[model samples]
Target: MSTTAHSLDRLIDESVFAGRIYLDGEWIEGGGGEIASIEPATGETLAMVGVASAADVARAAEGAARAQREWAATPHPVRAGVLRRAGQLWEQHAEEIMGWNVREVGAIPPLAGFALHVTAAECYEASALPSAPLGQVLSSEEPRISLAEQVPVGVVGVISPFNVPLILGIRAVAPALALGNAVLLKPDPRTVITGGVSMVRIFEEAGLPAGLLQLVPGGAEVGEAMVSDPRVRVIAFTGSTRAGRAVGELAGRHLKRAHLELGGNSAFLVRADADVDQAVNLATWGAFLHQGQICMTVGRHIVHESLFDAYVEKLAAKAESMVVGDPAAGQVHLGPLIDEVQRDRVHTLVQDAVAQGAELRAGGTYEGLFYRPTVLANTPRDAAAYCDEVFGPVASVVSYSTDDEAVELASATDYGLSLGIVSKDALGALDLARRIPTGIVHINDQTVNDEANAPFGGTGSSGTGSRHGGVQANVDAFTETRWITLRREPGQYPL
Candidate 1:
């Protein structure tokens, strides 16, 4: 093992660091070769992870198909037990997991800890699903007992992204498994260790049966294979809107269901009645958290014209005050972007917006992969940063004169995953929130937030209407419904 792997040996097993793919109850080399997981903050190679080819994905899917029957047949309590144990394991290894998250995803300690906490909470919440009501009795027109029941969707394919890998990946995995479905997980190669390898280890240690969850780390090809695989009945995807469209289209072609949780350019509104300082604090946290990599991060800051200038100035000052560095090396408020590709994309958006007449109130530069938190004022609606999802630490501020205008500006984008409205008048803010079409809304809070039991998803380009979380949503996403009827005697059929 290399020096980096040696350093991680205590946190992660050496066997995992040996760079193997977990499939079909075995750890083996991937047919697609390997990818090196790099630390964005330092540009250091943390681990060499095996990459799964399309063929490997097919094999994993087939194995999952075979294993699902038995897993579904297993006692519900027993399955729930495994998920409970996984939740405990997440908490037990919180420090270690946080360490991996910091190195793999350029996450600050608090963000990494948040991922850990949410992941554990997800597992714990999923544990309750097994015993939840799965079926309901219905009165039949004829003399027969009718029932509508939920059943596992067989093998489920989960494709997760690099940002907030643990939480995004586990939210689907835990619920699907607790519902007695097999899973084939495809994590981004950049975050293979934290997202893929850590998951496999956790389940294995928790006594989950083999072949139930396969970890395949690769890029688009592997994801495509999983989505197209006949054995895979459902696809749970979390990623860019561009990739989600392809996944949804391919799943449709195959006549399968896909739960797509795609990208978002959420809006954060500050009304004239709101406290300017408080609004600035919320906006900074919403826009700069995890370097603004979250899909729910506030991409558009819509402030009332009366408080717009003050909000911009305060936000810019907050951005400048934040420290950016390698989270693993020292204390810093923010970390680097996941890689140079992401850094460049973020910078390009900021530059494009400035060229289009958006005033650069603060930031718009980088030292290495660490992008300075950016604040833009007078951003044109057509500016790339304002119109698109920058997925970086960028706060694009725009002013609105009235509540109606604020709603119009906030709802302008094709994406509508989350919305935040700040106002002392709770009823008025709620009224404004009701007008916007979004999956989640924060009355006093910022856009970036999540709970394991909440129904999470969005409308429009953000995602399919299918949500993830809560007993009902989880059942709907990972299972299928069947109607059964029983007759006391032989019933005459209508001719």
Candidate 2:
């Protein structure tokens, strides 16, 4: 029960660290083997998590389906109360939650705090959904009362990633559960504690009924099993574009609705009229925060050709000035990538870009998993780092002469997740922002931003439109509409 700073040994109950899975109201070993949950910053095994097998996925799904009837019939205020309590619990246990976030997922304190704040807000926002308007009266040509109503899609399957695990997992889980649908969460195995275990504890303490929300953490096979389960109706998936495609395809094959929040190679456009220093600061944060693993990270810095030199120079200096280390040890601007695989991928992209004639303005190295903030100038369009979603702390800067050219360069990517435009004339920036087809756009700001109630998703390769936030989007995502017609008595005219 150590409550000291950076002390994560007892942040969670000892039982959670014993490698159990939460299923149908109990924490027990699933039908699978064990896997070690490692601390990426120190390469230490945090816990031995018991993996979930295909059998476990089926049992959880079946339990959720059976329990959903009672849950949906529960009073709306009671369901909403559970969500509100979960929000309070998240804040009450902030220290412990943030600690696990740092060690398990490599989030700096601020990033971890952001995850906590957003997830709590998500619970609060979802609370209102239990009582939201779910149906509408409609006119019918026949002598009957006609209505269109929203009903829970029963046993939603949530597939969340490691980056910002808490927020991503809860954004879907909270809303779906609040709306009376049972959930089967399949978090990335690399982040089971923060993403999966912590979630179960929160909702359980909040008084949610057992079997309503199950936590099954494992690899892709587990997710595949959950998706293919007939009891699971909708799939809410957040991950890379490549993986998202597979999930989408599988969900489609199963005849289920899949809400996909995929990857991004988002752009930050700096106009010639913008203040160079201010733009550089925004750019640096956009590309370096959370080691640039965010889906909305400003991967491509489209700078005005006139200010390109100064932008590159200042960005390079900012990158070099940043310190990368274990966040739990001390204050550092950036932390390690999730694991060695990500580290290798990020480093390889940076090196390949440099080898392809891109000028390495700063960085292109790593010490353990802590990759330095990298900046590349004049990166070729074909370079992997420039065109693709590198998912690293690497900035690819390219010069654009006109607004149209900037729009072209920004829209050329397969992703349309997020966009940022900075200029002295705010109206001008807003006008230019409209030209780019991103799901989220920030004027005079950076790319990475999220709010609990905002409609948050991207077009194109980024995701399946806005399916994660807002009352309308969540209702549309987790529930389906049914047309009902009622008659006082049987009235038949046809023979």
Candidate 3:
């Protein structure tokens, strides 16, 4: 093994990556050819991961289906114990996982560490799900008792994105498993090792039964196979809006349960009464965290005209001050995007906005995949940067003359995932937050925020459904409620 590989082995169990796929309690070489896992920071081939063919997906689905009944029959406490152990294991190897995230995903230490912590926290939170109230007793008429009980929906197919692979995948996987559903996880091709292999090893070490959680590493074909399979009852996905729409449509056609946590071009509105320094800090973190590749990254900043100039100047300076470089080398506030395609996409959006009369106020240069944190001012409403999901280290400042205009500009986008409001008056921010159509709204904070115990999702094109974080997080998504009633006495009838 190379030095990097050897170092990684010391962090995580080396056996986890011995083969490409983890199916039926063993590692196996995939039918599909190998894929090169490239480190975005240095543009080097990190490792070769095996890709799963459609047949591999089919077999994994079959294994999950076969194991679903026995796994579901296990006591809830037993399931919770497994999840709790998995959380402990994650905590033990967190630094290693964080390091892998930095090297593989180009995530800054803070963001990478945050993702790792959240991933483990999700497991801990999900441990309580099996013991939560899954049903209720209702008063019934005509001398009868009515009761509703929750039951597992059987096998689930999980498709996660590359941006925050561990947390995104575990957000659904941990909950689904806790609720007695088998999961066939298909991680993003670029992050197969950290996203798929590592997770599988953690669960296995936690004493989960064979075939309960399967990892199939592959491309779009594998995802399609899992979605089309009749045995797979639910699909939990996190990715772009376009891809989520396709998955949603396919699930609808198949009449399968689907939970989608999709894209977002969230807005941050700075009221005239807001503190400029505080607002600038929130804007900087919201827009440039993870190079602004996050789904909830702030794409537009709507500030009152009175404070617009000051906000723009301060935000520009803040963006300019961000450290951008290889995340594996040293400390950095901003890191590279996933690859060249994403870098070019962000650059095109910025260039187009400038061409359309938007001023490039701060940073717009790049070295390889590392695009500097960029701030734009006076961006036209029709500019791509303002109208679309940039999904990069770019934020646009648009001035609003009135409160109505602020809300209007914030709601003008086709996506309505998250909204951030900064104001001195808490009541006023809350009042405005109600009027916004996004699924999640934060007062006096940034749009890019999440917790393991709160509901996290969006509206309009952002997501097809919501996924909560507490005990009830995946109950609705992974289980079906059955209503039952028993008659104490027979009804009178003429025979």
Tens-place lDDT per residue, model 2, 21-46, is 88888878877777888999999998
What is the RMSD, in Å, between candidate 3 and the native fold over all Cα? 2.5
Candidate 3 accuracy as lDDT: 0.88
User: How far out, in Å, is residue 332 in model 3?
Assistant: 1.0
Model 3, poorest ten-residue lDDT window?
Answer: 2-11
- Candidate 2 residues lying further than 4 Å off, grouped into runs, are 1-11
Clashes of each: 0, 0, 0
Residue-level lDDT of model 3, residues 138-170, one tens digit each, is 987667788999999999999999999998999
Query: Mind giving the per-residue lDDT tens digits that candidate 1 earns over 72-158?
Result: 999989999999999999999899889999988999998999899999999999999999999999988989899999999999999
The C-alpha TM-scores of every prediction are 0.97, 0.97, 0.96
The true-versus-predicted C-alpha distance at residue 233 of model 3, in Å, is 0.7
Query: Using lDDT as the measure, what is the rank order of every candidate, best first?
Result: 2, 1, 3
Name the regions of candidate 3 deviating beyond 4 angstroms: 1-19, 489-495
| Runs with alpha carbons beyond 4 Å of true place in candidate 1 | 1-11
lDDT of each: 0.91, 0.92, 0.88
RMSD list, candidates in order = 2.3, 2.8, 2.5
